[model samples]
Target: MPIEHAMNTISERHRADILIIGGGAAGLLAALAARRKARERSIVDSDFRIVVLERNARPGAKIRISGGGKCNVTHDGAVGEMLVQGFFRKSEQRFLRPALYAFTNDDLRRMLRKRSVPTAVRDDGKVFPVSGRACDVLAAIEAELRDASVDVVTGTRVRSCLRQNGVFCIHTKMSDFFSSRLVLATGGVSYRHTGTTGDGLHIAASFGHDLVPSSPSLAPFFLRHPVAAALSGVALRDVQLSFRTPSETVSRKGDVLLTHKGLSGPACFSLSRDAADLMRRESGGEALVNFFPDFSAEDMQEMLLRHASAHGKQLIRKFLQLQSAIPSGMIPLVLKQAAIEGDIGWGSLTKNARCRLQRTLQSFSFGEVKAIPLDAGEVSAGGIALGQVNAKTMESRICRDLFLCGEILDYAGEVGGFNLQAAFSTGWLAGSSSASGSAGTGV
Candidate 1:
């Protein structure tokens, strides 16, 4: 399957029992779940039509490129753990709970497994197809669509969504559609290249939903520190990164990659949302990188003292190189930042110098950090507020028969497989609930 697009010609007018906007992960899963629910109610025999309107030429553009083309499908963990991760706001968690519990990560893997897509979970619990090909995952979903008779409309950007006389009319460049139930899974304003250009936000707002004010969620931070620029390509494993704002401090731990511009990788991306959000409010924020997060400054100082007592004649640089996990290339930078002479022997090291070295090794600072942009993130945060949507069904309280889910909602997860799982879960709920209703007609 070489990224097949629905290159079929658009129809002038279409009618469906359920019309789902966006053919991304959420939309596709919603369609599947909707049809499943419809069949269980004997609604399929009634000539029920389900359509997925995709703006791009093909479906799952983001999925094809996610996890470096491997597609981290979901995080492997207990459902309780995933819920307590604080990915969604406390108020919004109530709304997300039902969908997440209803369709767990194991459920997702089981669905893929049935389609011949074997998955493996990493040590950190991130799940990806063993084939390491995102297309396989997409192909599996596409197969399900074909099996369920989902009418996928591609290369058709939706122009407007309006409800009149209890029927939702969706206008697209390709055609116009009328349906009793309409689902907005158009995703958030990130990855514009993948066709997620914040279209869902405006559509949801038009239906009387309030937005949460969007920003980049799992993005990298641009450091103003010159050393970080020079240390580009240096990777630190299990490092802890903490950001300090005037109001509060937030931190995350994972592998960090020093990029030419700033910091990236799991640790940085996990904390990027808070950093970016803080920067938006005001300035004067700093990131403290705990080189040895497990060790306290006092602990390091005591260890160094014992080492100095044993190898008093050795050079400070050599002593650190031998006793610590800090890389050889990082030693010079650390010594310089600590204002300690690199050539100084451990025996000659003063008490003041010992404390300084311990502090530097414990917490190195990136003076000021600025995030790239919301679009640079894997998923955009903020969308239709959770208060207006039903958690059990994903249906809109403001408007009848209109549903919203995925990144189009205010919930944004961290850099694991959390975001994708959220999308799939919400989409399933929305689609199932949307299709379970009686088919309505226009005025």
Candidate 2:
């Protein structure tokens, strides 16, 4: 949507004690937190009005589509484990420490449970609704908001926000909103269809907060040479992916999905930010895939020699299909890449051929990354700089009553449930602090 100038003639006007923009994961939780904290403070509900302005027709559009419609609400674990295991950078870990601990994954789960939305934790630690429906999670949160008497106005596009005489004047397309405390949870630039188009970042910059120059994070890579159709849906488990950036080598280990375009899944998404950065910096950036991340070249050679000795008459392709971890569909491609014949017996393989095969297995070239579209990312990488925001309160240091939460902040977590957990945590802290009118006094 195009930005329009605030009109002199206001169609309508609304007032609230606390106003939250963008009713996404963060905004919805922020409204709930504010309501809960206000009650705890003995503030009369009728006297203090909390409002949420959402551009979409309904709230939590992104949430409904997350985790392939299952909605990975959060990662099930202690806050420390989540911080250490899910987030990669130390700076990000430090920034998220307080909020994540304050409103933990367990807390989130408990809230869902109360709303009659039972959850199940997968073996990989992803917490999802029992019914496997993302809409159920959104519905539960919406129910909480309704019960709390938090007014959520949908289809409201904010044109501009300005602080005038200790009041935040938010000019939307339909009406004007005024509030003392404002929460910007407009999310990031990714998932444009869901209404997260970096509006919050722009608003923050207007309020004197620096931005980190947005890029696509947790996105798939489109390769120059696409993979074969047979390998399109094949999944590689426990694989490592390495990409060379202008500054350093970025590597990640997890499961990878071979798409016809290139790669997807946890491992590829993890490296996407760096890969996108690398592509932006220069062309011809190549990714290397390590099918056997746990095995060294010598170990692989030794294993191959043992297999050959045991089954001398076994065809190389047949050995790879039955004995190796390489997928059946990928054997032909692997043989071709290694310059080996599929018909050749393992016993007849030359020493040079064995070494080539070992090398190929260790670092198979995934080809040059053609593109990593920023809009295609699950979450964006940049937003308001973290140092400008009070981590404990989720309030901006530059602007006192203005709080920023969710993907609007510069931290973008890995794929899974880390991002949503961060959103909930920060939103809770932001709402709680805004309601209490002081930092560290929030619930």
Candidate 3:
């Protein structure tokens, strides 16, 4: 959507006690929490009004597309387990503990149940709606907004935000809105089509908040080798992915998909953020796949030697097909990589040739990774610096009456439902804290 200066010149002004920018999962939760907190402190029924401003035509675009439209609501686990399992930094895990404890995954399930959206936890610990529709999850939030009487403005992109005399004037393409308390849950730079284009980061930076440089997370890597491209669409279970850089090497084991460009899947995603960071600083790095993760090099050599002895008279190609657990299509590729002739007989195979075959089967190199596109990622790392925002309240330490939540902060989690859980917990804290602070002391 293009910003129109002419429209802003004649745009009408609306006022509210609390203003939330963005109508994503975090924004929706904040709006509800703020309303609830305000009512709790108020002596009168209509004490303060809360409003949500969304740039998109509708809210929760990200939610509707999450988990392949099923909407993984959150991960099912204890707070400590979630923090450690998803590979979140120790410092960030500690910072998020209060919010995670305050609004547990059980609390979220209960809240959704009250909204008529029953949820089920998957075997892998991912929580999803029983209906298997992300729209239902979004509908629940919309219902809460209506019940709380929160004003929602859609199709209005914020042009600028100015703070003067303790009031924030948010200028949009359609109009100008005023409020003392402002909550920014606009998300990160990824998924620009969903209205998370790093606007909040830019606006926050303009207001004197330092920004950590943004990069893509949870995205497939593009490799320098043609092997991944040739094996596109082939999937392997129980494989280990190793990312090797000059400084360090990281490995993860899970299911992986070979794409036209490179690698993707849960295992690859676990290494994406660190891979992106390394690829950004250095031009490239090596990615090696342990196709036979269950067996060591010595174990593989022993197994291969036994199989060769049993099928000494057979062709090497036929012997590998009959004795190996690898996929039929992958065997030819592996043989080619090992520089072994498929037509060669097992009886004629030399000791050195057999050793080469065993090593290649154990670990296949995918060459170097070239790049990871920032926009193609599921989440974007780097946003508002963590130190500038209070993890307890999600309020800005540098500015008054301002709260930050969701991907706008410099934190990213591994794929699954960790990111969504973080959004909900942080949003809950920011909303209630903003309302209580405004009503008691008046920011």
Point to the candidate with the largest TM-score.
2
Candidate 3 versus the native: TM-score? Answer: 0.92
Report how far residue 55 has shifted in candidate 1, in Å: 0.7
Q: State the lDDT of candidate 3 residue by residue for 207-254, as single tens digits.
A: 999998999888887887655346788876788888888887777888
Which residue pairs in model 3 clash with each other? none
Please give the range of 10 consecutive residues that has the lowest summed lDDT in model 3: 1-10
The digit string of per-residue lDDT tens for model 2 on 136-202 reads: 9999998999999999999998888988656788888776877779999999898898998778887
Winner by lDDT: 2
lDDT of 2 at 285: 79
* RMSD of each predicted structure: 5.1, 3.8, 3.8
Separate clash counts for every candidate: 0, 0, 0
Q: Relative to the true structure, how large is the alpha-carbon lDDT of every model?
A: 0.83, 0.87, 0.83
Over 8-109, each residue of candidate 1 has an lDDT whose tens digit, in order, gives 222423877789999988999999988898898877534788899998899989889999898998998887677667374676566778999878899899
Which parts of model 3 have CA positions greater than 4 angstroms off? 1-13, 43-45, 225-230, 314-325, 440-443
Candidate 1: 10-residue stretch with minimal lDDT: 1-10
